[model samples]
Target: MSDINIELLINTYLVPFGLKILMAIAVWIIGGMLINMIAKLSRKAMSIQKIEPTLAQYGESTVRVALRIALVMVILEVCGIQTTSFAALIAAGGVAIGMAWSGLLSNFAAGIFLVILRPFKVGDAICAAGQTGAVAEIGLFSTTLTTGDNVCVHVGNGKLFSDNIINYTTNPYRRVDLKCQIANGVNPQEAIARLKIHVAKIANLSKAAEPCIEILEFNASGIVIAVRPFCNNNDYWQVFFDTNKAIADTCAEAGWPVPAPHQIEFHKD
Candidate 1:
C-alpha cells in the first residue's frame, strides 16, 4: 500500500512539474527567436517604406523590447505563475520604479520626439549639446556623434533634444567668414579687387554665390576686409583654409605693407 501511495504522489506532482519546467524553457527559446524575426521584418518593412534610419532603428528596438516582455510573461504563466498578480506587483511599485528610471524615461521620451520631429538625421552635421559632429546613431538613451577630430561621443537624448540644434547640412551652401587686414596705406578698392580675383580661382567655391570681398571696418589694426565665400558644407574647411592662403598670397604678391596698429605720441617741449 505504501509503495502504491508513493507512486501516485510522484505521478500526480513530480511528473507534471518536470513537464512544466521543460515547456517553459522551450517557450523561452521559441519566443526569443520569434522576437528577433519580428524585429528584422519590421526593419525591412520600414526600409521598403523609405523611413528615416533613426526612426526605423528605434522602432525595431521598441518592438523587440515589448516582445521580450511579453515572452517573459508567457514563460511565467507556463510555470504556473500568475501574470496578473505580477503585473499588479509592478503597478504597486510604480512610484519607486519611476524614480529609479527617471533619467532613462526622460531620455526615451526625448528620443521619441526626436524621431517624430525629424530635426536632424543620420550622417547630418549638427551642433547640439555643446558637441559638433556628424550624427552617427540615435539610440533610446543617447545620441552618438563622430566629431571632426574623429572622436566618438555619446550625448543623452534628453539633453540633445532640450538644447538648440544647428544642422549645417540642411542648406545648399554655408558662408565661410574670414577677415583679412590691410595696411592703412593700401588701396582698399585695389585690395578688394585682387582678393576677389584670387578667391574666384579656389576649387569648390559656390558658383551661384560669388565671393563677397568688401571693407568691413577700420580699427587700431588698419582696414579689416571681410572675405566671405560660399561653399558646400562638406568642403567648408578646405575652402576656408584655401581662402585664407589666397588672401595672404594676394597681399604679399601686391607688395602691400603688413598691417600694424598705429599709435600717436604727443611730445611736450
Candidate 2:
C-alpha cells in the first residue's frame, strides 16, 4: 500500500476505533470486578439483616445480572455502537423472553412475595398447594417439601401463593380433635370423664388448657364425643396419634365398646 493510504487507514480507522475497542474491553473487565464486589457487599448486608438465605441468593443473582447487562450496554456505546438501536433490540429480546417464561416470572414474583410475607419458613410443617409436608427449601421458582413419608415434593411458588396455606407452626399451640363414637348403652358422663383423663395423660399436652370432652351429636349408631386437646405445635402429630390410641384402649378396657353396624336382612319369597 502507498504511504498516504497507510496513514489514512491508521488515522481514520485503526487508531481511534482501536482505542475505543480497548477502552470498552477494559470497562468490561473492570466493570465485572466492581459488580462482583457490589454483590458481595449486598449479600453481607442482607446477612447482617438476617434475611432469608433463599432471598439473599436470589437478590444477589438478580443484581449481578442487571449490573452485567448495564455494563455491556456501556461497553457497546464506548465501541461506537448505536446505544438506541441496542436498547431497542434489548427491549424486543426482553419481551420475547418474558412471554416465553411468563410462568417462571410469575413464580419468581410469588417467591419474592413469599419471602417478604413469610407465611411459612424452612422446617415448618404446612399444607400448601394441596400437599402436606415440612418445608425443606424455599427457592425462586418452587419450594421443596419433605413429606411425612420422606418424599421430596417440588411445588411452584405461584400455586403455593394462590392456594390456601395452612401453617401448622404459625402458632405455638395446636388443638388435637379426636372424635370417639361409643355405644348407646354407655354412660355419657362417665365416658366424657374417662376421655378427659386419657387426654390429660397424652405427652406434650398443655397442662394450662383444660381439654373439652363432650358429646356433640348422637346418631342411631352411637354418641359422637368431641375430644379437643391442646398441645405444642411441634408435638401435634404425636398427641394426635397418642390420643386416638388411648381412646380406643380406654374404651376397650372399660368394656364400653364401639358398636358394630346393625344391618337388617329380609327374607325374600
Best by lDDT: 1
Residue pairs with backbone atoms closer than 3 Å in model 1 (clashes): none
Candidate no. 2 TM-score: 0.71
RMSD of 2: 5.6
Of candidate 1, the 10-residue stretch with the lowest lDDT total is 256-265
lDDT of 2 at 2: 100
Model 2 lDDT, residue 220, Cα? 78
For candidate 2, the 10 contiguous residues with the lowest summed lDDT are: 255-264
Candidate 2, superposed: residue stretches over 4 Å from native: 1-44, 52-90, 93-96, 262-269
Q: Please state the error at residue 133 of candidate 1 in Å.
A: 1.1
Across 1-269, the per-residue lDDT of candidate 2 in tens digits comes to 99999999999999998899889989999999999999999999999999977678768877887899899889988988998998788787997878889999899899889988989888889998889999988876889999999999999999999999999988878888879888878888988988877878888887768788998998877788998889987788899999999888779878976566555699999
Model 1: residues with Cα > 4 Å off, grouped in runs: 1-26
Using all chains and alpha carbons, the TM-scores for the candidates as numbered come to 0.87, 0.71
lDDT, candidates in the order shown: 0.94, 0.88
Identify the leading candidate in terms of TM-score. Answer: 1
